[model samples]
Target: MNTTINMTGNWKPKLMIIGTLLGAGVGLVTASLLARAAEEGGDLELNGGDLLKTALGVVTTMRSVAALGAGIG
Candidate 1:
């Protein structure tokens, strides 16, 4: 009798790099939009508060997604 098995190696580095780039791109776009919104709001200002809130929201969402993917959620 004979048996054979095949397995694929992980592509974690490439996946990590892609994830990092995607996160960075999201952060950059979010910051730009928040700044633009703050500027257009005139006297109704956030003084970085809006930006901080947006950043926290993004982080929280990412963390939740990661946890769900890892079966922790």
Candidate 2:
């Protein structure tokens, strides 16, 4: 009795790695964009935009990888 959830084959780990890399790339790109703005005067304002962008990236990456996996399987 095989208890595997994936019917595509032994590609679970590889897919996971790809998903992780995708997420990281997205997050990094977002962060870089946010960093483009230089600090003004003396103090810099803190914002949640960067965090939100990274979260979006993670979600986007996951969805993309899931879609790819489904298509392949």
TM-score of each: 0.55, 0.47
Judging by lDDT against the true structure, name the best candidate: 1
Q: After superposition, how far is residue 33 of candidate 1 from its true place, in Å?
A: 0.4
Model 1 poorest 10 in a row by lDDT: 1-10
Question: What TM-score does candidate 1 get on C-alpha atoms?
Answer: 0.55
Candidate 1 lDDT by residue in tens digits, 4-56: 33335666777689899997998799778878877898644556887798779
The per-prediction CA RMSD against the true structure, in angstroms, equals 7.7, 7.7
Reference-based TM-score, model 2: 0.47
Q: Which parts of model 2 have CA positions greater than 4 angstroms off?
A: 1-8, 39-73
In Å, residue 13's CA in model 2 sits off its true spot by: 0.3
**Highest-scoring model, TM-score:** 1
Q: Tens-digit lDDT track for model 2 on 18-71? A: 768986997798666656653334445567996698679868876886786566
